[model samples]
Target chain A: MTLNDTDVRAVLHRATDHLSSPDGLVEGVRRGGRRRVARRRLLAGGLAVVTAASVAGVLQFSGTGDERIDVASPLFDEPTRGDLARDPAFLREVTDAWRGATENAELWLRGEPHVVWAGNTPKGKAAYVAQRSLDNPVVVQPEGERLIGYAGFVVPTANGLRVLTFEQFHDSGNLDGNSQAVLLGPDRDTLLVLDFGHPVEYSPSMSYAPDGRIVRQRLPVTFRDGAASLPVPPQLTKVTIAVGRAPMSVDSRIHVVNENEILFPDGKERPEPRRFDYVLPGADRAWGAAVAPTAWPPGAVAALAPFLDSIGTHVVDPEAPDLTVFGATPDGRRLLVSTIQYDDDPGHAVAMLGRGESEYPVVATQPVDWAEPLPVRLRLPDEQGTLVAAPEAKLEYRTGASGTWLDAGRGAALLPAGATDVRVTPASGVARTVRL
Target chain B: MRDVRGTEFDDFVRTRSVSLLRVAYLLTGDRHAAEDLLQEVLEQVYVRWRRVRTTPEAYARRALVNRAANRWRRRARRPESALGDLDPATPDATDDVALREAVVGALRAVPPRQRAAVVLRYLEDLSVAETAAALDCSEGAVKSHTARGLAKLREALAGSGLVVTIPNGSGSSR
Candidate 1:
């Protein structure tokens, strides 16, 4: 039977109808509400004191170190520019500003702030300051000194250089993975991005027109010495910065910026409806790790017990393997599959077919060499067709060797009915055939 | 001291808690988490009682959606629990129970914002404009999120032998 809006609503209501508020709900609300009010009042008073101290230039650096001396670090090794990097007076002003900003912030500076890069852009003069933070409340365990600070641009005003924007950065320790973008400039139209290691390709944003068509636009990024600057449209609120040349590569890191400000335009510009059919839910291995257990079909655990035992306790990870049930055949036989990766061992894909009431036989098991471009193909038992697993690529499959290629969806797909052999093509690789 | 505002807030909670709890349960997919989420949203509503007393439900709903989104993001960052060797016994004898379980499980795969859009638009029977207000996005965004959410739900449900078809112009206002 086909399910529609009414059926979906009915299903949701049925799922939640039995749930009710627990006892003391109201009392709990009142108590928490009162506490929040008290905290807000206390925070307001503290902020007032901080503001006064900042204005008076009496903000004390609490962490251990000489705040006046700029410490040498690998993160701040880049040469400074913009004619102000060598000016001692200007550098001191920027350091004071950094101290004031972090005084009330969660991350406190451990060492003296040093200028990493400074330059004059179309907007104004900006400098990238790098500092060491011993205490980062965000991370659970504070390692040694971590590089954390902000990059700000100052626009010329009647009264000296006014700071237009200050974009904060915290070192995740992964240089190739660090990325951040912010809208700066007086008009809030210049997109400034600080991407370490790899140069940013472009920043793309998606919106929908009134006619329900998806509109995608990419802002080209120009990088000079690690900082990227580009002009962005005023209407766009969110952008995903793609780092590295290969956008779909596993090594590429995509950082989504301004998530809360995401907006869609009205019917001003009509763009063709982008085919979202290739997108699949929970395609990422991380998502599979989280949701796979709850998503397992009935009797699947008992069915795969033998296979699990054969793999031995040492090879089996304490964490669950990423499992996906492609679907069941017309006669109740289900295809169960999982991608298993063990530390210091080669990754492999395991497939099992569940039949009758209590029999699950292993069908196809193949090693997954991630360095290769070929998709992992597992042929089902009894000429049922192949189960294709390619998480990072778009897939297409043809029923017969010479048949037309059809969209195989995103992560996985089962062969069409009565198909003997199938050819699979990945988004980045050449086509290969999996025969039954 | 309990004042008139406190009394009114209490009354609102007493009357609307059941429906609000249901919304939380659907959004969270777990009963205990749902209770915690609803109580948290209600606490925020109580704190802003004077300002949102006239339209408390709308304010509470918007807060619930935003909080759920935040909770999902936090959960994504943490390490996930390992799957047990034994599956929990579920009574799938009845089609209704099976369908309910399928819908809830599928909802877990959807992104938090898209899930909120789907819940508000379908389960709550809200208009596009209402869903937009709750999600703090434009009407067109509401449509896009809902459509994408429905598409994902349909694909997830496909394996369960339950085909979910989106109606033509599903995200049109009301």
Candidate 2:
């Protein structure tokens, strides 16, 4: 028999003529598209876990089999003026390095290099000065005496010069008196200290002092580059960060506060705080990048190494979570840290000090900035009959055994004697149970 | 002016869906499976509709052929159902109906890859290279599959009073 293309084409066409396009083809495609996306996401999540485990395993095994490895402190030993003057070799090295760096045209084209900080020796003479070269933008410490102590990174921004630094003035007997970290911003003529007169500890309450007068005191959450830098929200002004244990199973959440006002614990009306909660991957080997800041001073990484070493190993675990919140005072001067576990125990705060006392009291409770939001905020009455008002904010009040929630918009639906078993939920933010 | 991407896609589906469904039906050999294949292809096209709109038909047809090929690969382990059972309608007591049924039965017996090559090469009238691209293979494989598929059809339709001839060299068979 002779077989040709026409015979085959015509016959096949006639055979399949009864079949038609599916009625819900577009809808089916939409559903299939969703499933495909879910599959891709699951695959990507799996790959991230595998990569984290491989990295953790490599870090764990690459170390020497010793049960404990002491990571040497990166801070200078016995930072004093006498040590600076006596070290001719180090002094010569510092001078030559600065001279060579300045000679390069690439290091001074953008701006002139200036001495950001100068250390004082025992005899009240300048021991050494740390100058930042803007052309290349690096911290350079030039020679002088060795005994002096100075640690910080001076950053020049569009606003002005900001310094991340810690210094102890040796003039008086008050060791803690002069030991302060400051972040100086462009807003005011005076310096701003983030944790001034405060012990170097995990996630200290932030204080902003302009012209030596305290302007603001509040908690801030800071996240750094673990996989990638967690960028500062464009609208946020002050950021303070501390690492804490996971409040729940998921690693993070962003809580948007209501735009309206709410009564603070002090009975003064203030807008509720909006913040992001990031729970580091728990004890499980599954992981993401350990969070950290993208930009740090030349020596800041070295200074921070001891803090991380004191807490845990290179690998991060989800169940046994290890995290650190890196923040500065409003002025961006002092370094602040907060963590769940440090030095193999909870409630331990350590400031990296060259000499003198370093231990400080653990905060009685996790700072409000780092804690999860409560269900509600119901302030008791003041001396006058004015109930604390949250301007233009709606509140949901739940009363009695009926398990029903009733709207009490700006105190409109409440009884004069107050309702029993009332729970108040803000128009936004977490809710709280209120006693009438 | 509003965006025209959604309207353009709807127009293309309205105009070309029947032709696409026919190709899908021939490739899948089942009505339900043909609809599934067509929908799957449309979904993929919908995702990149902006980029594929200019050559939407070609893009969709390629996807349909490839997806059908994949389904066949997965279903390769299953035994082939009897061709007569595919459509139980007794031929409408006509000579042309019997011959058409005989051709369909013969085409069903061909393996999926060979069937795709045959439908693409003979029915849809794609070149050896186009068929190779649609099947994601070399031109040589397309040529070999087409030849073997036609030979199978010639044998299956020998006694059914239908003559099937595959032209040699570089000329159109018609």
Candidate 3:
């Protein structure tokens, strides 16, 4: 049976008619709103102080060019940690090693590096250092001392303490704080994630099968002095760091790191590139490069004005170059497509099809990376069949789950009338069957 | 003394929240995300209650659409695979479950702007001009987005073997 616009509206109503505003929604909004206002006020007050300081020239460099101003870091006030906390000689040696490692470093060190935590790991002796540096002047602010540090595992060899790996830590002012995880241990099986602000939980890296099934392994993270570490399970390719406790909210900060990239001590080798069934058409472009904007189609501009206007709301600079491409479905419907690439973040694309003179309806929008792009599916308005856009993949379709696969056109094809699924086999990878 | 503005805000929430939540549900395609998005928008509305009380529903809607768009952009930045773990949709069965799921899934695939236009125009039954006002774009743009959005919905439904008829005399007006 065919559905109509009225039927579609009925379906939407039926789908959402059961949803009611939860109790305490108003109270929650009020509470959150008050906090938001308070935060805004506090930020405004802080901005005033910074402005006043700038007006008074308090932020300007005050000393002569050759004079060195050494201010002790606040971290020095905090007591040290670990088994060698009271061992002055051991502390001195770690401090010396830090100084030597950073001696010729390009960072502007305003004060000496101090070892704040020295502990024994399964791998070897490890030390965490905190130093005063002017690497980020904005963060340094009125006090003029910004904390930049490094943590590493040290092993004693024939000569002396060999610094296995020293991972530098600095905040990019990301309000969420800075975190770095390194793989250590003799077999590189220990994962140490050092967070400067808050403790975080982690899950072993996940791998996605060709069929989009995810295999994830969870490991408990043990936290000690703002550092979380876990034993990396064998064949773990990556790790995902998440903040907060159980039942984490959707907005919780989560980061995925390829384990091979952080192989502590000797992190010089790069891992092999991951293979996917379908890669982006032009994945090699240097991010943030100037992309020539699609010359707006005069015929399609009126229909796309809202999309174009909405771009500014999503991107940092609406004036920056954006790339938009135009294509067509199997039914010869014109489609205007644009990839929403902003900054270094991965993005999705917008595709609107021209239908009946000036009506341009959106047909398909999907992510540009990570997810499988094979069996490129685009449904044409009014049952014109699904348009598959795999120029190099062999295509087959079936009318039912157990139906026989029938050969479909190459490059692109409209699914056969009443087809339920399509099998897409790329030039090299395994064939994937996508439900229509 | 009674806080008149607070009472008015409470009344607005009590009266209009159900409809607004439905819009949010269609926009985000996840119940939890929809609730979160609605509450966040309501908070913004409450903060600006004095200025927006005049047209609180419209303001709330505009805020919802924009917030949903921003949320989509943020979600897009994460690895696409990670998205499945965030607020998975709860299953709800109904007589029209297959058709509803197909329609909703298809709508979720549309771009944020186009989806907003469709939800506002088709689902909420807003006129082209009203949708344009809420989207803060030109009427012509509204026509284009709604048309394109509807076209996508139609195509997606058709591919799922559910043919949907376009509204009578419904085409983009030049």
The C-alpha RMSD in Å for every predicted model, in order, reads 18.8, 27.0, 24.1
Fnat, model by model in order, equals 0.55, 0.46, 0.52
Q: Which candidate is the best by TM-score?
A: 3
Prediction 1 global C-alpha lDDT: 0.55
Model 3 agreement with the true structure over B15-51: per-residue lDDT tens digits = 9999999999889877788999999999888767778
Lowest-scoring 10 consecutive residues by lDDT in candidate 2 chain A? A49-58
lDDT of 2 by residue, B1-174 (tens): 122345677777767787888788767765567777887788677656768989998788789888987877776678866665555555454655565567667767788778888888776778887788788888888888888887787678765665544453343422
CAPRI rating of model 1: incorrect
Say which candidate scores most in lDDT.
3
User: Candidate 2: misplaced stretches above 4 Å?
Assistant: A27-436, B1-4, B79-104, B159-174
* Rank list by TM-score: 3, 1, 2
Least accurate 10 contiguous residues by lDDT in model 1 chain A: A47-56
Judged by DockQ cut-offs, the docking class of candidate 3 is incorrect
Provide the clashing-pair count of each candidate structure: 0, 48, 7
lDDT string for model 3 (A1-436, tens) is 3346676666677767768889899878866674444333323222111110110112223354223333223243357766667778878888887666545232235455666666656655656665654333222232333224333334433466554433333332222222244455544566655544444555544343332223344444566764555665542332232333222333433322223333221343333322212222221131112222234445455554433322111122232223344344455565555444332234444556664345665556554452463424655566655655554668889998999999975545656448898888877888888887
- Tens-place lDDT digits, model 2, residues A1-436: 3655566666766665655556765545644543333223223222111000000111111232112211111122222232234555544444444334334211211122223222321212122223321111111111110111222223333533233222211111122222122222232111112221122222322232221111222233322110011221221222232212222111321111110011121223333222222221220111113223355333444444433322111112122223232222122122223233321122222221111123322211221111222212222222111121222244444446565676655422212223454444455765655554
Preferred candidate (lDDT higher): 2 or 3: 3
lDDT of 1 by residue, B1-174 (tens): 124364789989999898888777667766677788898899888767878999999899999998888887887797743221112325444665566567767888888889999889887888999999999999999999998887787667766775455543432357
